[model samples]
Target: MQRAQRNSLRLLQWMMAASLALPVALFVIAATISYTSTNDIADREIERTLDVAHEHALKVFETIDRSLAELNEVVRNLSDDTIRAREPALHRRLKRLTDSLPQLKSAWIFDADGKALVNSLASPPPALSFTDRDYFYSHIDQSIGTFIGMPLTPRPPYQGARFFSVSRRRDSDDGNFIGVIQASVLPEYFESFYARIGSDPGSFFAMGRADGAVLAHFPRLNHDLRLDPGGPVGQQIAGQPERGLMTIAWPSDGIERRIGYRRIAEYPIYVSAGLETSAIRARWFATMGQHLVFGIPATALLFLLLAFAFRRTQHLQAEAAARREAEDALKHSQRLEALGQLTGGVAHDFNNLLTVIRASVDLLNRPQLTEERRQRYITAIADAVARAAKLTSQLLAFARRQTLKPEVFDVGQRMQSLHDMLATLLGPAIEIVTRLSAEPCLVNADAGQFETALINMATNARDAMQGKGRVIFEVETATTIPDTPAPVSGNQGFVRVTVRDTGIGIPAARLGRIFEPFFTTKQVGHGTGLGLSQVFGFARQSGGEVTVTSEVGQGSTFSLYLPRVPPDLRSQRLAPNTAPAVAGSGMSVLVVEDNIELANFAADGLTELGYNITLVDNATDALAELIVDANRFDVVLSDVVMPGMTGLDLAQAVRDRGIGVPVVLTTGYSQALSQDGAAGFDLVQKPYSIEELSRVLHRAARLRRVRDGAAE
Candidate 1:
C-alpha cells in the first residue's frame, strides 16, 4: 500500500512540472518571433523615410543645377557681345534673374582680374572688389565648370552676413579664363527647409563635399559648417559607396544614431539624413510589450514566469503615454522656436535701424560738424523715422485699427504716381511693369491705406521673386452684383488692381493659410508676417476683397478689388507737392497752442520760414490777440486742443469776426479736425516735417489769396 501511494505522488509532481515548462517555452518562442518581425518592420520604415529624404534632397540639387545651367546658357549667348557686361539692360536682366532666386544674395560679372563689373544688386554693389576671394582665384588658377566658395563675409560696407557663392568661368575664344559670372547665396537657404523635409526632430540633415567636409547642416551649429575629428557626419562616409547607412555617436549630443547618405550624382557632393537609435528601439520595445500581453495566457499556468516581461508591459504602457506627451512637447517646442526666431529677427532689424538713428543723433550733436554733414545726418534720421513709421503702419493696418480717411481717386493714376518710388522699393533687380487702363478705374479709398497696400503687395511680390522678377500692376474695371454666379468681389462696381510676380509660387499645403495673421514663409525678422494680413484687412475694410493664386515653381498673383465710383465723382485733391521749402516772404503768422514748448517751436519754425510770428498759449489768449490786431496776421495756425475753448472754436470765432485769414489746425490725432467747428479748414498732422508745415502754411496763405480774389 505504501509503495502504490509513493508512485502516485511522483506522477502528479511530473505532470505539474510539464504543464509549466511547456507553456513558458512556447511563450519565449512567440516573444522572439514577435520581436524579430517588429525589428524588420522598423528597418523597412527607416528605408522609406530615407528614400523620402533622398528624393526631397535630390529635388533641391536639381533646382540649383537647372538654375545654374540656365545661367550658363545665358552667358554663352552673351559671349558674342563684347560689351554685354557694360550694358545696363543686360545688368538689369541679370539682376532681375538673380533676385528671382531668393537664395542668391547677389549676382555679378567679374573681369579677368576679378574686378566686379556690373552687379544685379543696385548699381555696382557697395565694396565690389572681389579679387581676394578664393572662388575668383580658383577660376583664375584653372578652368572649372562651377566652383562653389566656402562661406565668407565679403568686406566692410557689406554687413557681416555669412555667404557662399557659385561661380562659372567666363572664357575667351583662346580658352583663357576671362571674367566669371557668379551668384552668392546664403548657406542658410539650403538648410532652411530641413525641418519640413520629413526628417526626424533633432536628427542631422547635412550636405557635404566629396572630401568629407560638411557644407551645410540643419539646426545650425555654425553659420558655416565645421569639420570635427569625432565624426557625426563626415569621415564615416568618406569612402562609403554611392548609397549606404552607418551608425555613429553624435559628438554634439551623446545620442547614438544611424545615418543614410547618398552621393549626389553629377555633382561632387553628398546629402545625408539621420535617425536616433533610441527612437528605433521604441518601436521594437513596443512590439515586445504587445507580445508579452499576447503570450500572457500561454504561460498562465507557470507561476514563475520571467519578471522582466511584466515590467516591460508596464513600461510599454508608460511609453505610449509618454509618446502622447512627446507629441504635445513637440508642438510646444515648435511654437517656442518660432517665437524665439520672431523675436530674434525683430531685435536684429530694429537694432540695425536704431544703430543708424543713434549714429545720426551722435553726429548731429557734434559741435564742429559741417552743415552738409549735419544735413546728411538729419536726412538719415528722417529716413529711419519714415521706415519705422511704415513698420508701425503695417502693424496698425494688420490689426485693422488705423484711422483712414477714404477718398475718390483713379487707381491707374495712383499706380503711375507711385511708379518711380516703387522702383526704388524693388531696387534694380526687379522690373516694374504697369498695365494701367486708358479708362479711369475710379475707387474711393484712403490714399494712405491705398499706397500702403500697394507697397505691401509690391514688396511681397519682390520677396516672392527672391529679389528679382517682373512685377505687374494692373488696373481694370469689373462689375460685381449680388446673386451673380461669378461675382467681382460683390454687389458693386469694382476696380481690380492686381500685383503679380514671376517668382517662386506658394506651395499647395501653405496656400490656404497665407492670409492668417503672423503666418509667414519668410525667415524670421525678414518679414513681420503681417503684410498679407494687412492686405486682407485693407480689402475687406474697403468694401471689397483680395485674392491670391499660386503654383509651385511658377509664381504668385494678388488681386485687390475695391468698389468703383462714377467718373463724375469729385475726387478729393491730394495736397499738391510743394516745390521745396519756400521763404514765408514776411507773411504774418498767428500761432496758438496750449503747450508752451509747442508754441515756441511753432514760432521758431514760422519765423525761420520768413513769417512774422505772434505766439499765444491758448485759443482764448489767441482770440484776445486776434481782437487786438486781426488783420495784422496773414494766417492763423493753432493746435486742435486747448485748456479753454478748442482751436476749432477759435477758428469759428475768427470767422464770426469777419476775419478772412485761413486757419490751419494741427494735431497728432483728433476727431475735431473733421468735427462741427472745423469744417472746410485745412488740416496738418502733428510731428509735421518742416517741409510739410511749410506746405500747409503756404496753402493757407493761398486760401487767403483766393478769398481775396487773388486766387490760390
Candidate 2:
C-alpha cells in the first residue's frame, strides 16, 4: 500500500509540472508575437510619416524653384540701373507673388554689388549690404542653379524671423553672374505642416540641404542647427543617394531612432523622418503588460489548483504583493488627480464665459429693448469674448507662446495704480498694502503680462489666506538677486518686486513643484494651477527670475527680479487711435460666410455703411463670383473658416488668377490664420463693431483703388 501511494504522488507531481510548463510556454510565445507586431506597427507608421515629409519638402522646394526661375527670367535682361528705376513696380510684383505662396517669407532681387534693389517685405528693401552673406558669395563665384543656403535671421530693421534662402544666380547674356534672385523660405511653414499631419511622442521630421544645413525641424527652430555629413543619415544618402532607412542615435540630441530619409529629386535637399526607439519599445511593453495582466493571474490559479503543497506559501506571498500594489495604485491615483483637476478647472471657467454669452444673447433677443439696454447687453457679450480670449492667452503664456510687447515702465508707479484694484479683487476681508520705492524702479518688460502675473500672485495669496489676510506689494532696487545672492556692493541694476502674504504657507515637499503646470495644492474646483506656471514662464521669457520662500503655517513671500533700465530709456506709450470710421462710398463688396445668418448680418451691416454687398455661403461660390467679374468688387470680405475651400484659398486663387480685387478676411478664430497669418491679405477679427468693419473694408478698398491708379 505504501508503494501504491508513492506512485500516486509521483503522478500528481508530473501533472503539476505539466500545468506550469504549458502556460509558461504559451505566455512566452504570446509576448514574443506582441513585441514583434508592435515593432512592425511602429516601422510602418514611421515610414508613412516619412513619406509625407518627403512629399511636402519636395512640393515646397519645387514651388520655390519655380518662383526663382520666374524671377530670374524677369530680371535676366534688365540692367542694374533699369531695375533700380523700375523697382517700385517690381517691388509690388514681388510682394504679390510672395504673398501668394505661404511658404515664402519674402522675396528679394539684388544688384551685382549685393545691394538689395527690391524686396517683398517692404516697398524698397532695406539698404543693407549682403556681400558678406553666403547666398551672395555662393552666386558671386559660380552659377549653381538654385543654391540652398543655411538659415539666417534678417539684419536689423527687419522683424527677426529665421529663414533659409532658396536662390538662383542671375546671369548676364555672356554667362557672367550678375546677382542673386533669392526667396527666403520660412522653416516654421514646414514645421507647421508637419505638425498638422500629427506625430507620436519623440517622432522627428527634418528638411535639410545635402551639405548638412538643417532648413527646418519640428518641436523647435534654430538658425544655427545643423547635421553632420559623416552621420548615419548622411552616410545612408551617400550609399543610397535617393532614399533609404536605418537605425541610429541622432547626433544632435543623442536619441536612438528608426529613421527614413529621402533626397529630393536631383536637388541638393534631403528630408528625414524618425521614430524614437524608446517609444517603440514602450508600446511593445504596454502590449505585453495587457497580456500578462490576464496570463499571470490564470497561471497562478492553475498552479494553486495543481500544487496543494505550495498553496499556503503562494497565498502568503500574494497577500504581501497585494499590499505593495495598493501603495503603487495610490501613488498613481494621486498623479491622475492633478490631471482631473486641471480639466475640471478649465471646463468650469469656459462654461462660465459661455453662460454669460448665452444669457446676453437671450436678453438681446427680447422685443422692444431700450437702446441703452441693448448697448449694455452688447457690451456684456463683448466683455465675455475678451475674457475668454484672455483665458486662452494665459494658457498660451504658460506654453511659452505669448508674444511679449516689451516696453520700459516704472514698476513702482504701475503697482501704485493697481492698489485700489488689488483691494477690490482680494475682497474686504483681506487687507492690501503697498510699499513702493520712492525712487524710480524702471524695467523693460510687457506691462500687460506683468499686471497679469501680479494679479495671479495676489489671487494665490487670497486663496492661501482663505480670503482673510494681509497682502503686500513692494517694489525696490536690488543690488543682488537669488541667482547672485552676494553680488559686489553698489552693483544695483535690478528691480525687485515682492508679493508677501500673511497666510498658511506651503509645505516643503510641495513648494518646489508649485510652478509646474497642473500641479497645485488647492482643491480641484478652486484653481487650474496655470496661474503660477504663467508667472514662471513670463518671468523667464522676460529675462527675469521669480523665486518664492515658504515655511509651513508661517506665510509665504514671492519675489520677482527684472533688469532695471535707466530712467532716460523709458519708452513713450502710444495712445489708442480713435479716429472715426471711413464710410464706404458706393464701394462694392463680396461677402463670403458659411453661416447664412452671419452672411446676412455682414451684408446688412456693410449695406448700412453705404456699400453694395453680394453675399455667398462658401469660398467656391465666392470664387465663381470673382471669376465672373473680378473687377466688379473693390474688396472681397470673407470668413476665414468656410466649406469646400477656405477664405485663404479664395484669396490665393484671386491673386493667382491675376484678379485685381483686394481680399479682406474675417475670423473669430482659425488655425490657418494662426499658422500662416492671412498670407499678406488684410484681416479683420470677428466680433468687430460695424465701425471697425467699415474701417477695415474701406482701407482695403482704398488699396485696391491705389493699385489700379498705379497700373493706369
Candidate 3:
C-alpha cells in the first residue's frame, strides 16, 4: 500500500508540471500572436492616417495657391493705367474680382511712397502707407508676376485685422515701375477652410511659418498658436519632412504618439499627423482579452485536476517572491515622494534669484552714463545676464518648462558647429573624439537647446573624466528592442547620440539618483547637480529617452535616443533675418504706465526723441484723454499688466470707440502674453532702455500718424 502511494505521488507531480508548463507555453504563443496582430494594425492605421492628413493639407495649400494665382492675374490687369484710368470700369472690375473669389478680402494699389490709390473695400480709394508692411517690403522688388506674403495684421480704411497679402508690381507701358497692385485675404477665409478639413474630435491642426509663427489653426487650439520652438512637436517639425515617421510623447495627454510629418512642397510649412498608441492598443487589447477569456477557464480546470493529484509546495514559493517585490516597489514610491517635495522648494527660491538678476541688468542700461562707462557696464551686465539666463535655462530644463525647437540637420554638422565651443567649455584636460555617422542622420530638436544639452552632457563627461580622460561623441541610427532598457515610446527606429567617457564610473547606489535635481555626487560648490537632470528632462521632453550604462571599474556611456527627423523636413530652416525697421518719425504718442518710475523714464525718452508725449497712469485715463481729444493721441503706449485696465482691454476700447490710435503695448513679461495679443499690438519687451523705448514708441507713433493721415 505504501509503495502504491509513492507511485501515485510521483505520477501526480509529473501531471502538475505538465499542466503549469502547458498554460505558460500557450500564454506565450497567444501573446506573440496578439503582439504581431497589434503591430500590423498599427502599421495600417498609421498609413491611413497619414494619407488622410496629407490629402487635407494639400487641399488647403492648393486653395491658397489658387487664390494667390487669381490675385496675380488681377494685379497683372491692373498694372495698365489705361485700364485703371476709367473709374467706373476699374470699380466694376474690382467688385467683380472680389465677388468672384470670396477668399479675396480686398484689392488695392499702392504708389512708391506706400500711398493707397484704389481699394475694393473703399468707396473712394483711401490713402495709406505700405512702407511698414511685411508684404510690401518683402516682395517690393520681386521680378516675378506675383508674390504671396506671410499673413499680416491689416491697417487703415480696411479696419485693423489679420490678413494675408498677395502683391504684384505695376509697370507702365514702357515697363517702368509705377506702383503695386495688392490683394488682402481675411483671417476668416483661412478659418473657414480649416474648419472644413474634417478633423476628428480631440484632434487639432495648425499651419505655421518655418519660424514657428502660427498662420492659422483648425478649431484654434490656442488663442495664439505660435509653435514654441522649444516645444517637442515644434522641434520635431523643424526637421526635414522626407525622413518618415517621428514618434513623440504628446504633452497634452501624456500619451505616446507616432507622428508622420511632411512639409508643403513649395511653401515653408509642415503638416503632421499624430496617431495615439492607445488607439492602436485598443484593438490589440480586445483581441488579447477575448483570447484570454476563452483560454483562462480551460487552463483553470487543468490546474485544478493537477492540484488534486499533486503536492502544492511550489505555488507558495512564487507567491512569497511576488510579495517581496511589491514591498520594495512601495518603499521606492515613498522615497520618490520625499525627494519631489525637497526639489520643489529649491526650485521656487532659485526662480526668485533669477528674476532679481534680470531686473537689475535692465536697470543698468540707463542713458545717463558716458559711452565708455556704458560699454563697460553693458559688458558686465551682459555677462551677468548670460549666467543668469543659463541658470534659468537649467531650471526650466529640469522642470520641463523650456520649449523645444526641433529641426533636421546632419549630426556631424551640428557637432562640428559646437566643436570649438565645447573645447573651450571643457578646457584642455579632456580629449574629445567624434565618431559621427557618415550618412546624415537627422534629429528633430531645438538647435539651441540641443546644443545646450550636448554641452551639459559633455561637461558632465569631462567632470567624470577628472579632466584627464577621453570623451567620445558618437552618432548612429538604431532600432529599439522590447524587454530592453529603451525609450518608453516603444518606437523601433531612433537616432542614437552617445556620449561615452573614460572616467570614474557611477556607483550602483548613485546611479538611480543621478537624474534627481540637486542630487549631486560631487562636493557642494563643485556642482549644482542639475546637469544630468537637465539632460534627462530634455530627453523626456523631446519625446525621446535616455539611459546610462556603466561599470564600477570601467567607464560610462550616456545614450540619448531621439526621434529622427524625417528626410523631407531636414532642409526647413527658420525664416532668415526679416527684422522690422525701428525707424519712425514725426508722430504724436501716448505713454500709459502705472509704475511712475517706468512711465516717466519712457515719457522723457520719447520727448527727447521728438515724439509728442501724453502720459497717463491707467488705460481708463488714456481713454478719457482720447475721448476729450479724439485726434490728440496718434499712438497709445500702455503697460500690458496694469491696475485698472490691461493693455489689450485698452486697445479694444480704443477700437470700439472708433479712435484710430495705433496701440504699442509694453511689458516686462512679454513671454507671458498670448502671441495673438502680442502680434495685435506692436510690443516692446520690457526692461527697455530709453533708446529702445524711444525707437519702438517712435515707430508706433509714425504708423498711427500715417493711418490717421490717410483717414483725413
Scored by lDDT, the top model is: 2
Q: Among all windows of ten consecutive residues in candidate 1, which has the lowest summed lDDT?
A: 481-490
Report how far off residue 607 is in candidate 1 (Å): 1.4
Q: Best to worst by TM-score, what's the order?
A: 1, 2, 3
lDDT of 1 by residue, 210-256 (tens): 65566677657654455563464556655565877777775555578
Off by over 4 Å in 3: 1-300, 303-378, 481-492, 573-581, 584-712
Question: lDDT per residue, candidate 3, 105-205, as tens digits?
Answer: 77776665676656677645655577787656654564565555676755754575576676666655566666766777665665565455535323344
TM-score, cand. 2: 0.42
Which consecutive 10 residues in model 2 have the weakest lDDT in total? 483-492
Better of 1 and 2 by lDDT: 2
User: Using Cα atoms with residue i matched to residue i, what is each candidate's TM-score against the true structure?
Assistant: 0.44, 0.42, 0.41
lDDT of 2 by residue, 100-179 (tens): 99999899999889999899888767788998888888888877778888888888788857888988888899988788
Compared with the true structure, all predictions reach lDDT values of: 0.73, 0.82, 0.68
Q: lDDT rank, highest first?
A: 2, 1, 3
Model 3, CA-based lDDT: 0.68
lDDT of 2: 0.82
CA RMSD of each candidate after superposition:
48.3, 43.9, 45.8
Off by over 4 Å in 2: 1-5, 221-223, 308-712
Model 1 Cα shift for residue 662 (angstroms): 1.9
